[model samples]
Target: MPDLRKEIINILDGKLLTPHFQPIVSLTHKKILGYEALIRGPSNSPLHSPFNLFTTAERFNLSTKLEFLCREITIQRYADLDIKEKLFINASPLVLLQPEFKKGETLRLLDQYGVNPRSVVIELTEHKPADNYEIMRASAKHYRGMGFEIALDDLGAGYSGLRLWAELLPEYVKIDKHFVHSLHNDPIKLNFVRSIQSMAVSLNCSVIAEGIETQEEFKAIEKIGITNAQGYYFARPTAVPVKEIDKALFAIEQDTDCKSAPFNNATTAVQIIRDITPISAKTTISDVMNLFHHNSELTILPLVDDNIASGIIFRDKFLTKLFSSRYGIDLHGKNPIKMFIENTPLCIDKNMPIDLVSKQLTSLMTNDPAFIITHNGEYMGVGTLLDLLAEFTRQQIDNAKHANPLTLLPGSVPINNQINQLLANKIPFGFGYFDLDNFKPFNDVYSYDAGDAIIKAVANTLIQYIPAESGRVGHIGGDDFIVIFTCDDWLTRCKNILKAFESTVPSHYSDKDINAGGIHTENRAGEKCFFPLISLSVGLVDPVSTSQCQSHVDIADLASEAKKMAKKIPGNSLFINQRMAAKNSGNFQSFTHSATKLHIVN
Candidate 1:
């Protein structure tokens, strides 16, 4: 083989090999929070991507040198970026162990460039097996002491990620792009990502979902609770300045406007049944009668053939048919259903709206019953009156809860009840005690209606982002909303809701407020200060220990501590108290009632 040593030396010495940045966006607000600096070699060099460069360098025993150079360049390039946002730079365990690598020098360079070490996120990529975890842990401790945050990179893509995360309690974890790329369409991948997110949250770490490219992928990640996201869909790697990134971020926010748009202007059976449940044609009259007796609103039954819907069976018609039969005739042995099968069933397509379906079901003459749902001219299923009544009951409950005279979100009682239920169930949940970051100032600047609109917008975003099945969110009076998601996929779900709220809330502001980047106001000290644009401060608590769960009051107190931590950051977001995880995990034996706390927190 040709002498590769000379080429490697030349590539490292002269050219500024650095990582290029790709911005991760807030899906709901459409703003760039930070960038993940991807390693790249010198232009026109054979080792363009750091993957090729590092592979060659490692083979030649120059991995540490390359890692140092990458770090130096990343700090130098994005020095002027805000201290609040993060600059993610990739590092390896082996490279982190180098004694000669001057962390102080790196910190000095960052300070010179107007960057804070606290904002620099060093991602530990598992490029090679980490043989000595102690050394890695020591390196992590050293960096964290200097206000540098650590991230476990390529998490869930390798066997070692979990071990590495446990040993080095990183503040952030970057899930591999492979899992995130097609998560929306793949149920298995989505579930796996959700599990990882929940684990990270319990560990008190935030997750940055990678490789998001499509709207569906973004939505899926959002639904699962990923707070920070990076991939081609947001922005590709580039050597752009922070100002340019800010402009792109602003454009993203504008794109995710929260104006409500109607689903579509069309009528079909599917829409009608939107509020109704479909039953099989094979279902016996006895089942239908039982459903009707239990539910007074049970009227029409939509019968389905195979997956195709046929026609509906009306409650009144079925009852009439039953009574018309000979007294004490063997109804069960005879095809009692055959009588109604002969009736001309009202049929509709499966895509109709529930409002229209409700109207249609009511319009049918009291005597003429039953409407069927057909798709592509094939019978699929049936809709019954009982189904409609059940849907109506659900709607009534939702409407009654949401119709609060105050903030108009589910009321305080509902919010408190949800927290209590989560406590009772022993679910690993997070409570985000949200408050307007600078609401009083904003309210003073504009009318309370505008402020109220902002509050409602936040509430709406929380409801939209949280999965209807897995989580329960309630308005906790004023600008606060309490959200509870079970251990399954709670982390990603919480993050997405916070990001969406952050992105959407600014839309209700005036042009001046938008231009200032947030509402501007004075403080109590008689000093002029820029009140941060409004965002949410979410306190996350995994009440998994008995000590942590002394009572609902105690749990709320812990959650409040986390909320304060999140508020200390610049934007609308969530933060978990570090001790919450450790205490919940039973790592500390100091608490006397550890076992009891564990049961309570569980």
Candidate 2:
């Protein structure tokens, strides 16, 4: 062990530690946001892992040297790689006390290597409390003043990180790996991270869920609105930052978790009042008053009697009663706040749906400043109507982004998203893949406006025929459409869609075409031909009938095969992949008019 310490120190002296870069993705933007610089000691050495290397250096009293060397190498290599994205460099708070740290060599090195200070975020890694909060604050402020951002690293796993958060107000706070691990299985961890996120938002800071190696954990974080993600789920740390995502990780849809919120109401209510501090009901008005005066941000206090919300008291009303009367404090300060609690304070059970709460909020009188949220008769927290409205607005924005602009129906993203959810839950449903036949020839002859009319008409038919409660329609660009049917009568409804499409499409054609049974047009390659009125080719895939379809991609591909089989038959066809299809009818002779007139469009 003693020999290992010297070996580690020698490794640092020779700069044997190189920075391995891990990419951080923005779950919201679905793009690479930045890279975190992780240092790795040389291979085949006891110091190969950063954990082992740093621990050995600390045992040898060379922790500062090792940490500084790590930072130096990270800055040098990251700049050399010309990574313009923000580079997060880890720095132990303990090292801030060193004299060399004060000389600003790191900033100079950044400049020397063409890395801008603005592009750097020094992650304050603390396994133990700093020697002095003032020194920590001052040191962090110094770098931040020079365009460097600060981040509190391994937040839940470290000592005094919450205090550091308050003292330094780091630009970003990365929830520890412990908090992120198995998050899908732990409600406590999810709530904890959510609380941290709410506080971080209030502080105007970002939350990065780090060490995310599983899809469940990644989705768990995104579902709660933490968008900045760094984890092996996205990319493993490599000597070179992942400039392009690998195929295995590619197309992993981000920001689709808004719909994954547990039972909507359950998840939404937890988000509200998540940051408010609860007080014991037995507490005196004097103590409550003191808390109110000291913490100006305090608005509503939930009086908890044995963890159950006995009542809620608003700050302004409580203070008003005390201050309005000169002897009010002397008379009642010693008494419990339960007596002063509002007679009609808006109390809501935490299990109530957010929409139900929103309705109650709108009906409540003005004096009810806050709503008391209780779980199993115990005080959970206090929520304002504002919080509920904000959540509502957020959901709306998320929904709008997934919708298709042309049809106002959900586009490809939502179609795939809903399919993923259904398959993940093993729900039986019908996926209808719709493509228009002769649409290209029709659009070519009639112009794009008429092409759009047919698309809109096809969309309208899908909407009208598909039962609203049991079906969702999606426009997957151009003339392609998708319908996910949750009802048992999906087959009948899909038949209705084809029937409606066939009957209505002829109306879009000119009087001459209607009499002619379709229009005459020249398709690509400049060949003159007679094309039938626009008809739909629907590929119906009963995913549950066969072994479950693997993914949305598989679902689409299978449906496409069925659709190709359908289009081979001519006008208005329904091809179900795992069953019978409409094909080889006499309409084929009328549809082709001439084989030279044909073209395929999906």
Candidate 3:
């Protein structure tokens, strides 16, 4: 019955909302990097969280006023903190674009509270539509120029998060806890987070995994590459300032304890085969020479007859015997099988202890000949010192192939090969291309290392969004990445990936750049200007007509063109570019240029 909206407005104007501080911890040093400010309505009020308050305020057409009041009060309350430590303040895109929210006014407010913009990180939430992103990005650039940092909040949870990340290259990307929560139980999630961490490293941005509650979750994220964390397990949102975080610090220190145990439990075995060729068994001396050439390390070849081990011919002895014989050339056709001694060599099992075999072979002292292994008096497998060493070398190569050199992700080759195999089977699939918008300028301003970090962050975001049953994600080098989905729910997977990427991307930038919502750069004329905000333009190419008529190259080209079209649209956009239902016999219109020649595949 009462005007709840009016009452809430009165309460907010009176600065009745209480500000709570949650600590953002550094996983590496187990120290508190800064505190994120959380707003709560008056005790027992219906609007408890700022999210609810702001949502209600927008419905009542009073969001701008509410945001200003909250921002003003939050800064004034935490003004005395050390400048080096950061303070996170949440701001919606709508509130940021307000005419009253000018750069000069925001700076003046910070000056009044003795706070520097450099120390204040404005966390941009995905509460409003990103239709006006160019304007929002322009505002973000202005604010960043004044020293405030920017952050894309709730990464990995929204549709436009990836697009927002490309447009606004934030200094730090806060990884959504949803992906971090089940990392230990999911290989896909673990790999996804690792990719994000790698991208963050490339962008020169810091990463903080949010919502790390259980010891298992914390340990999983820490092992895979997350260095900052927040959640209930560490410390929940609190109104009181935290002077010490001994519990959180201790939990991080013990995080590795949970990881090493599982890693140590993994065991594997190697298979080996034995050499059983002999000179005496062959009719011709050339036969012995051929055996030695095939296996250079075959010092002694064992001869067998009628299921019984026979004579052993040493390499040096056989060579001397062959050269001394006047019938060497004519012996090529001779049957060495009949000339070899019968029941002369010994055999052992492949698994027999090497120490025991070494002693036995040494005691025999028959030209220090190599021993062979057999089962049921038949050749089964081999085990030699050199074989063991070769197996070890092979294992290393296999490990390297799966490891992403930059993000330590199983490299692009494996991902691509897997996707191609899946497609070759004519399975229904969805492919999405993810790219960072306006990343070049960010890299120029911040450095290539920072750009690399952003790339890894984007890759991690895509990995997190992929469904458990979804196909592999191929890193197509640099900032471009591809994710394939074979299940019935492909659109959902693509949407989820885009959302996560945008939400987590802001953690990569300084508070100023993030607050500005876009990177600043010089134009061709060398005049300072703001490029359009960065974002991911996802082009989805489904296997409909594409399956029958489209080649992989054709589909890929179409997807890329669709992505470029999407990027051209202001703010975050997604486009599904399918092949034309009916093929045109004549010239085809280029999406960008004029009508062009068409080449039909025969």
Question: Which digits, one per residue and each the tens of the lDDT, describe model 2 over residues 224-334?
Answer: 667578888889999978786552342232112223222122234666765467777678989998998899987878765455454568877787878776428889889
lDDT of 1 by residue, 130-209 (tens): 55577668768877877888888888776677888887889888889889877767879978987887777557677788
Model 1, residue 498: distance off in Å is 51
lDDT against the true structure, each candidate: 0.62, 0.72, 0.63
Alpha carbon lDDT at 577, candidate 3: 65
Tens-digit lDDT track of model 3 for 411-446: 545555444444454555666676777888888888
By the lDDT metric, which is better: model 2 or model 3? Answer: 2
The window of 10 residues in a row where model 2 has the poorest summed lDDT is: 586-595
Query: On a 0 to 100 scale, what is the lDDT of residue 261 in model 3?
Result: 18
- Of candidate 3, the 10-residue stretch with the lowest lDDT total is 261-270
List runs of model 3 lying over 4 Å from the truth.
80-84, 99-102, 127-132, 247-602
